[model samples]
Target chain A: MKTAVSAPPARRPGGPAGRRRPGGGLSGRLGPLGVAAVAVAALLVLAALLAPVLAPYEPDIGSIVQRYLPPGPEHLLGTDQSGRDLLSRLLYGARTSLLGAAAVVVIAGVGGTLLALVATWFGGRVDAFIGRVLDLLFAFPNLLLAIIVVAVFGTGMAQATVALAMAYVPYTARVLRSVALRERRLPYVQAAELQGLSGVTVSGRHLLPNIAPQILTGAAINFGYAMIDLAALSFLGLGVQPPTADWGLMVSQGQDSLLQGYPQQSLLAGTCIVVAVAAFSVIGERLGGRAAGGRA
Target chain B: MNDDVKGTDGGVIGRAGGGSRRTAGAGGSGGSGAKGPGGAGGSGGNVIEISGLCKRFVTGRGSGRRTVDALDDVSLTVADGSCLAVVGESGSGKSTLARILVGLEAADAGEVVLAGRPVARRPRRAERRARARDIQMVFQDPNGSLNRRRTAGSAISEVLAAHHRVTGAEARRRVEELLEQVGLRPAHARSLPGELSGGQRQRVAIARALAAEPRVLVLDEAVAALDVSVQAQVLNLLSEIRRDRRLTYLFITHDLSVVRQVSEEVVVMRQGRIVERGSTTQVLDDPQHPYTRLLRDSAPRPGWRPVRAIGRDAAEVEA
Candidate 1:
């Protein structure tokens, strides 16, 4: 209790980076799963970018002589009904599924986050108006909305992507708006305002950073949803057209010959969708834990 | 959960009564002569006036516990450019009163007039912010008070950049100015609150309070949690700041000895009411109320050796 007459108020209790020590830290536990997902994602990207090189045989290449041959060193997972190489189509198909999902997430995350921020920040009439519009969009079943969008634009990569983005953007916007509203009331935000920050500055600088973790987690979850939606649309024939090898279209093409005992084509397509969604879900779960822990 | 250390000399300086032959000189330090323009210079009268301030929180739905009155008609006025210390124990309505002053909590019924303007019940956001800028607060528990994610310079510059419209280099320069003013080195600019010591964080908190260039500073137990040594330094810094900048202080604390050292006027509060009010010398040395006398008696006094009672009369007096 012998108080020093002139003590400075600061005491650096720990060294720099007080919250975290360097090295992998908690991410160490998540590294393998994270790496696996990332590796899959990378392979998907590479296959998409270098589809010509990675594909063992030309996707459309076939021979009546080679057709119906199953799983051999020479044939390699065999040939499809149209004499196409199943392995080549599978490799090429990863590119389409991943790229389509990425496009959908980017568009939806950015557009939805911005819309939500505006609606929440402005509040009152603006908030009510945006909320109603989003509710209207949410009223439609996600696949149904995507289908209507695909039908309107006609089937293609771009049209499929737009349909998925439009379908999920409302969900993202509504969640982000709720998050922004909560951030708007924090003492630090009030402190920010008292310092003379403009509303736009506060919303962009303060609201955005606080809501980022939530948005990122939401985006990951949405990515999984978009993959399912995109696959369904493709399955319906309003997705990536034939010649371009997409997983969903591949599944559709293989369905008719199910009774003939050639099930590998449909199985390959279904596995792609399942793996992609699982990867995103696991990574999302890990990220969500990290985000929650970081907050605490 | 924390021990209440009542050791006489822990940090209390110069016991309350009869000990200081130098006490008379110390008493004259802050008034009259100190009122000279060169001495303290900032001694305007009644900058903030509170009349019948009362606050009650209604918790639960329908029939529940009785309404808890946080402030029971608390009335006090802070002299312009002078430190007014409001001393109270825990649950004494001190923090509630402080919050009401800063507009963080709305009072149930009362009036707070700052610099002659009646405080609006619900001021417009811009006006409230401006008012907040004018009457800044320094919270206790510096670590909990600051936003953990923000860097020191960003936190300080935010106030300047946000309210003053100065950004980029100009804002950075102002942040440096504020940091330097609060006794922190410019190198602290990029450091986060978590990077700094408790004392350093408090300094940053002070720097943040000063960012708005407030005329009235409401320190809500600002130094209560610091080490005794650090508390002294912060108190001295507060004194210097008050003197140099001519800032008015609404200094709230639980330590009577701390109240004696820094504050010119002292208002003693207990259970949401001001039990005693006067100049520090008048109240501490010659308390009129029984509660004030009890507090003073309970306050620690070091270096005065207690003599063994001479007989039955002394024993009865001790009892």
Candidate 2:
């Protein structure tokens, strides 16, 4: 009995709140690089939202006479082979690119989270079945799955986005399921169960809230992956078809001008994709780090 | 071995004798009446009667699989309104017994009759809720028992709302009453589990269990995580609550000293079976089984020296 008293205290002195010493809000926890990532992401989103007002020329109505023009005062960032104002096209392209990626994240995040919650909450055979299904989904590469969907659905943004979302579901579900499994075994969950709270009630009120950080982290990371996959599909001419002013479409359409020693259009659009993907990746990684630190 | 099994009945008689020995002031309540001979069949019947409970866990697969008997034919009875301590070292299957009784784990074989109704092997939602109202559990770790996001008041009120129809202001009132009953300040209800100390958090856990107004409370190592001083305080609180409400307890712990402090009857377990059991004084003071004696001798006392003979005692007990 005295030896039991001498046993090390299982609990840390301060609770989880005390251990999470980083600043409270997202901005406060972010370092210089994370802040820059947030700034770039915010600026791109703002630019996308204000495309009509910000662009000097109509994205779709290009002047053929100005085609392949080098970067100059009249044609900022030069003109594509179709003579569409590259700056205006890129600005408008941000909108479709961002929106397509957002749609994929929302679909995959909700779908994956739901699958994870069901698998974890029911456990047993339900969990095993869902696990096998997710494993099957995981076997397909994201681009291959998206291309397959595009082929079947006849080439569209919605089809490609939905397919990529499906491909990403296994990743999110697997991560969330592992975290939720741990949370499910905690005493509070068992206490709720012992209260005879319905499975839905326990899951919604207890399980989800506890695993909210992991879900957010998963969403942030998936957002970056979704953007890249959707762009890849568009570049392949399997998504957001011609004349949509999408960055990937611009890159593909500018391929002809690249052979004419006018690389401005493809280069600018490719740079946009790289910058935007980097921004999201940085923010997502930071969020994942913070979530891990908070848990520890 | 058969004689030891018969000693359980002897424990009831010893409890009856011990009940009379209690001070008239303390025994004035239903304590004496509840311990009367044949109480098992009377109005103060066994609230929790578990028999032949068994649970096995298999690890690995096929060729490498190993089966562990977590609980092997474990049996015990807790008289209504009495505290029966289940004492053992780690892996003695005491915790398994509590889990099975609380419906958290399924037994491979056995029956658990709680408040006169045999528990369902696989209870439905309604039956689970009914069982919740009949019995509640206070776990060992205070940090893990309550949701950190929820306020202490909300945790207790949630249980009350689940087991009873009370809601809104009525629920709030009951929450406060329950918190106060567990020696927590009414203001503490607004605080989260993370904002409280280990001992205070445990009080909230106890209050949450009491909110269900359960007839039986299975406390699984309830105070093993606390400091020695806090352990005494929580133990006192548990005893007072039991006395005031006449709630039965299945106090499970590895600490023998705690067993003496909080229990009237105790069942000593070794590996998945009960090695010995009787009134607390009879078993602790005059332990008949070698394992029980080893457990008693292992507990540190004033001027007690460390002994390296545990292996010898274990071998003796095995024989």
Candidate 3:
């Protein structure tokens, strides 16, 4: 193209540098609910990471002599059926559920986003094919699909993580496909196309960046559901195998004790699962509000 | 900057593509246009020549399918370094003409010979890429054309990086020059599209088009969204850019007031057909066609008042 060879600026605008301003920080950008939810999530992550160090006593070492002692100062928060510290086991259990949720979010979020981008970009036979496949996946309930995946792959931490993530792909892709399709119609993308930029370049540099907030919000919401779903899976013996100190595993181990005049272990672990899921869902909604251009 | 700005001083048009980058500039600016029609015709030949271009759009589905002719065998040409303004009301096919010229929408029938190359309906990647640089476009809504993801500097520099053989530092330097050329200060380059005012955003859009060093610029109602004062400023900048760059222009606008200011030749269209074409002074001063007269009379001017249809009045209809 002979066009750009000599199209140089004949004149220059004289101006001083240092006029650029910084973007607003989180407090300025996010609403109060978002800030609070983020703070709670951060705290939960930190507590889970330091579970072994923060826990007051060894979680697995059992004492049959003082088994089933009620909430006493010497064994604060009481003891499990094996007379191990219930508080310590609950704290350690946080690690498995939280990390499992994070892994599912990452796998599902990335895979779904890519698929949505392709579907929006191609928009004909390829789009129809993806739609049909997603519809087929959607036919099964989330847990049933996950169970099938886990069954086929064989149960374990890695298998369950992948299974849950695969089960979630259809849902994530559906949500993002609408957003991506809307963005695909934007003039800037058309401008990029006219410029002869490749599909990958347009998506990476233009389309994806603009819709990233929606992706982030979707991923955040998925994290909470994923946490609850994984815990349920563990409760059914399809995830977080025994001796892993998972909250779902603890609840399952303590169910028999609930009718034996002690329900502390199950109650505490269930409370932890509820708190984490609620915190994540709140954060996701707040971010979603921002993405939707809703008022603060 | 030195690599990009060496003055031609009586050479072939001063850009690389004045010699391949037409479609690339056009592609980015033209909003998915495939390529410009042809080569950078020798400075002696007409820069753009169209013959019987036609486009039909199908509406509805199945039993309700209906085809509407968006463009009806339009033909025109412009000498190198000249401006041609195509004016019409909404649905008159003026925009469709502009779109086809830049290769954004494929024509159902007819030929577009740019710099004199016959643009294929679907060209190879390299051919389309070349056409992008040859013909760039400036859209009606400045805010819609720019990538909100990028700062103004990055937006302009991206075009240079993609088509030009310049280094990073050179590209940055050229971006500063382009910003300055469009009347944007270097300080404004880091601002995102959302942060900039409408006028400032237009300046960015113009800078992006200029980055490709285009031989032809298709401005599609580019100033339609701006306030009066800003529209004047932008119009001046466009004319100045054309003069300095020796670029050809295809100015598409419904506003006849601007046609006289920016173009040398004028083509008037009604219902997807060209009703009249001539020099700006000739067509505008003594319009031969009824459509051209309607356009001239309706255009706003000092002391002008709206004229209702005399024969279509209620009293006349009742009688």
Would you give the TM-score of chain B in model 2?
Answer: 0.87
lDDT of 3 by residue, A150-181 (tens): 99988888888999999999989988898889
CA lDDT, every prediction? 0.73, 0.81, 0.76
Q: State the lDDT of candidate 1 residue by residue for B1-319, as single tens digits.
A: 0101111111121122112222111221122221212222222234566888888877776777667777888776665566778886677788889888877667889888775567786566776776765688888877665666667877887667545777366767777787787788876776776677778888888888887777688998889889989899889888888766777788999888899889867777766778777678888888866566656665667964443343443244335
Better of 2 and 3 by TM-score: 2
How many collisions per candidate? 14, 0, 41
The local lDDT score (0 to 100) that residue B181 gets in candidate 2 is: 90
- Model 1 chain B, poorest ten-residue lDDT window? B1-10
Candidate numbers sorted by TM-score from highest down: 2, 3, 1
Docking class of 3: acceptable
DockQ of each: 0.15, 0.36, 0.25
B74 Cα displacement, candidate 2 (Å): 1.5
lDDT of 2 at A192: 92
Best by TM-score: 2
lDDT of 3 by residue, B1-319 (tens): 2211211221122221231212101211111112222323332335676777788989999999998888887776655566778888888888888777766677888877776677876555566678778788888887788876677788888888778899766786788899999998776766677667788888889899889887788999999999989999999999998778877788999888888899866778777887777667778888877666767887889998865883354234234
The CAPRI classification for model 2 reads as acceptable
